[model samples]
Target: MKHSLIFITISTFLATIILTHQTSSIKCFDHPNPLNFHQKIPVNCEFATRSLKTKRKSSNDKFQIKFTCGMDDKKLCDKVQKGFESAGQIITSTISIEIPITIDASFYDFCKTDNQCSIDNNVVAGGANPARTIALMDEDGVERYYPQALVKQLPFEHHPNFGPFDILAKFNSEADYWFEGDDSQIKPEQADFQLVVLHELVHGLGFYSSWNDFFDFVNPKGLTPIPSVEGEVKENMEMIFNGFIENIFDKYLVILSSGEHASNITTIINTIVNEKGKFYETPKDFIVKFKSSPQYLQSQIMLQTATTPFALGFLPKNANSPSEAIVLETTLNPYQTGSSLGHVDYKTYVNTSDFLMTYKQDSGLTLGDFMSIGGNYTGGPIGPRLRQVLKTLG
Candidate 1:
């Protein structure tokens, strides 16, 4: 009965669709089919995953990204404390200077309670983290760490724009925690607590913008092969996620890419081309070139212009409402060809806000710098708040 109840809740949540546009009907908004060229191309997650995985294990000197601790151990905590202090008096008033780190699997086990916790979209997958609070600075000075589950049970949504914006980690499968401050899971040197703190601090601050993770239209069918151009476009998609853009994980970003059938790719691409500039616009069902013609890209530009004000908290409605946005250049179909099409879905939470911010400030910083800063520093207050609300639980 409990399992059935959980299934019902999950189904209802997945089936839920929130469209914020004032227009009565959903239209392409532009003509000439901006994504006509790449309509029927094959694409899949395994191909992209394989490519990314291969890149991770390659010997070639490609773009090698790594996370590093910002300050030396001696000043790490101090630097983080100071960052909190700069944000507001809340850091000193609520969180303490000295934090406690505890690891308990039992605490995480309790997070599965329906009333207490829900899956964290970020880590929901094979070997995923079980429910629990990985880290927390409570009202007292004590910073607590348990399995991921305990943290999942926290009552208040850290950000109001998104639902139950508590901090949690979704897992790929049943596995141990990723950051253990030990060499076994991750090298102690690689723990980068300062980096994590900065990232979370941004979540603590809140976000004022919205994002599209580009996972809605292209559902993975395992039959179609991801094209070479698709890989490059995917990287560009990431380019849009840098800096402050990553902070809005709490926003309900529509998955504009991904589909169970081949036509879904074209749908996503069309959306992409329709909403080119200004961020959060998509052509949904079109897959044209990144450097395609300007006229073809106008649809996207218009979509961006129309959506920008709402995403930036100037929508003339609820300032705390989750703004609408479209995902482009990625796939979300998570089923095999023989599997039911209904089971496949396109959508993912904003993993990080740096991509969007970096895109906004491309002229000022290198891509690597943008990523590094995104991983290391928390964005402004509003971005993190939005991130908490939009984040997905697998």
Candidate 2:
């Protein structure tokens, strides 16, 4: 009787435990639980350091940009805003599109001294919140300084840091040294400065990387607050080269006939030079002038790459100019004429806009008709296509 009672009690206790376990809820592996379900559940919660796709919310809300400057900062910041607005207007006009962000300008009157000017973070534009917006600074909330040594520390010495918001631009207030005579179209001294800003705006539009990886490596030491005399000289030299070949229509004479066409081409060239900086324009001109540079020739071809300069290598010589020489070699027919070699030469600048429109509108026309007069495309169709896009964008 005693044994039967003991056994019955034990069985009852075991049954109760089993029933409770069966009715309980499932728990994630990380959650604390009294039950042994943690081992049974398969949950993978690995953190990703870098994501391939950048996430953006479609709120239909607009962002406002305000410019802040010091008392004696000169008109550098104001002038920059004007140039940026010009580019923005062109983009809006050409595409009939408006960016989600709107621009506003104000000159800050905080930091003015004999040496350097300072900025007060306390007084921000109404729409701008230092806390809400990305600080664009280190953990201590201190702005990063651009000096010669700082920039040198970067992977690419003194290269620009293209950020979306609250970027600090340090440049000279004078434009006289940067521009000579009537060469004010591109304003060589400010080319890189403009390019960096443009690049940052592209970032704001989600054209580049989603995070830190989107940045091009530049030395922080080089960005420190130091006056750069050599930098100004370099910028001025670059403008001369960029201004030349961008209007190849002038000397070629074969294609350039109208004043309107010349004016438009000149404007487009100046725009590109301003955006890319004068450094890139020199090598670009070398290719077009000689009619043998692949990289230069490729710029005229329309191509697209969100991250890299793919179409730059397509041209034979320059980035935007069309080919100048076409070589033809033929073997003589024995019956018609004694064994002899025949050749013909043709030199002219081809208009990419005309070709791209034709290709988009008509398909039967061979690629040879648009690329070159003859149908000899040993290289793939990339160079031709990229030039088309470049022309359209311009």
Candidate 3:
């Protein structure tokens, strides 16, 4: 009774660009291959769990963290574990989660071998994702994938196939990190390990997008669609996608120019699918027809909207107007897969209060430094906008 699940890992990177020039350019994009959704093989729910030796609960009893250190040094392992605990405590105190969430945290050298690390220039601080996801119906009567961590908070019946842990978090043990408890102690050249942990944990709680360019080769220029998971088999031996489906997070996304929801599959299909009620059966079939049809032009337009500055936004739940929408990271010219749609615009939020979710993080500056410049520092790295988003998602 194994079900195929799609997992997305959002990695935090220390940008190579200097702090002074961060607004103009930030090279924090993940390596293309690992970032591509199509390149990753689907994981089975049964085998997703990991065995960790140490376990600790947040002070508020809202989160239980199971941790393991792959690094050889015991002192370094203890520091990283403490960092994870500190991050979990921050999150537990901020949000009210009735069910205690369990996180599996691993501290390891991501680039120990030659091909282990993806990015050549920048150091990947860490990455995190939900251990599993369940396909459930949303308020609009549309079925969408919800992260296991979030699902536990909802009223839905507990999904039987879900793994023991809600979130799977991993950090780069080799990267230069400030492992001290105080944010003020973080050096300019070193990334704040606790801050990075907080950032990664949020991603695991479903701060990501499934609206990607997975089917780009079919219509290269303007191909950004939530690819149909039509062939995926579920644990009950049932097929998942009858048509295009989106993750729950995608429901909040809107095209700023047109004021249309990104999850409006009917409008998208009408625009790009040439024939009515005749969807392509497979990727190969879609490629043949798409290349020979005029529908690709529409796809190019879609891509344009995604890449254009201030074109895409996330409208909070029950918002008054589009003007209140939170701008997403769409300024990246050639749409860098992982860093583009899932993050806040780097240029817009670089030094602002919403800097936590931005695509690039500048090394050498502590969380306190960002709060000082941004003016309002309530607590942890979870900025105001990000906190609003997490609350809305739940």
Candidate 4:
């Protein structure tokens, strides 16, 4: 039940209505017409039990924006706890990376479960990673301590001041948000509660992937799918792995589709632990072993369109001219394992204006980067090629 990415950047606003949630009827994706939205703002309902926290700062910044509502309206949990304290003061005025963090959220009025994370417009409150995978190459490796990516140019090494707030998010108090209520901002026909709390706090701040803890460290029986026989799964199962990746987002994951950067994350987990072919014991879903290896899935879609080149920029489908090339859904769609293989395709940057890390936030584009696709928007708070792709991850 841990799969976060309904950002509505998983968004559509297409009102493909479907409701049902009580005793597990679960079927999200809602929208009727402000059955009730912002309802003329007036938060801090003063109800405090399950959750409610606040501690803002200024002169040198400080953070703490929490709120939890199971019921007892407190004005819809103080309008999404003051719209995540106004999206945590716009992510503390574009990052320098400070900790003592807490952006914890929860509302839940219904939409019980296709695995409980609401599912109407395909469940619109996903950003659930509690990412805690640290163990770069054991001197002992079993230690396990986590919390990285506060992004001051993070290459790796976290948990110092502690941020990545120990997970606690759940939304859908009957859908249709559109915060900043008494309206000063958040106006794009609403549904931008601080751009889905800055895209689920950027995967609870780690930009995600322990590759499902390396598929539960080589499928100790979890992601359930290894009955291969048809074409005998091979295109890079690299002979059914022994690569042992403990996840620092799999050391900057690379297949680079051979546009170069050859193969990363310890050379594709030691090229699937030194492949000798003729193998196949267990484990699956790296897109089912890269689609059973059709030339390593056309060299990993040619290294995800040669490293997300604005995903074939502004689609004439030329992805922005490498002599009219095109691939720009900005990589990682492989059937969405670990939240759309680490995000950014909100239908290929829906309408692009920084594209809140591409998944949904183009009410006409406000927060931006890709400087209209030439790329250069240091305005920060998550853009500029997703802050230069989370600074080449850990």
Reference-based lDDT, each prediction = 0.23, 0.23, 0.63, 0.39
Structural similarity to truth (TM-score) of each candidate: 0.22, 0.23, 0.78, 0.26
Q: Give the Å shift of residue 246 in candidate 4.
A: 7.6
Please write out the lDDT profile of model 1 over residues 24-53, one tens digit for every residue. 111111101111111221212111111222
Candidate numbers sorted by lDDT from highest down: 3, 4, 1, 2
Give the alpha carbon lDDT tens digit for every residue of 1-394 in model 2. Answer: 0000000000011111111111112111111111111111112322223221222324332333455554454565556555455434433333322223443333332133223232331211111101101101222332222211122122332233222332222222321211112234432222222322332232122111110100111211100010111111231143132222211111111111111222232234334435544443333342233233333222232111111111111121232343331111112111000001001111111233122111011212233343454234333222343223222222
User: On a 0 to 100 scale, what is the lDDT of residue 363 in model 3?
Assistant: 78
Candidate 2: where is the Cα deviation over 4 Å?
A: 1-64, 71-74, 96-99, 103-196, 210-394
Q: What's the lDDT for residue 92 in model 1? A: 25
Model 1: lowest-lDDT 10 consecutive positions: 1-10
Which residue pairs in candidate 3 have backbone atoms (N, alpha carbon, C) closer than 3 angstroms, thus clashing?
188-364, 222-299, 222-300
Whichever of 3 and 4 has more lDDT, that candidate is 3
- Winner on lDDT (1 vs 3): 3
Displacement of residue 357 (Cα, Å) in model 1 is 9.0
Candidate with the greatest lDDT versus the true structure: 3
Error of 4 at 12 (Å): 30
How far off is residue 308 in model 4, in Å?
5.3
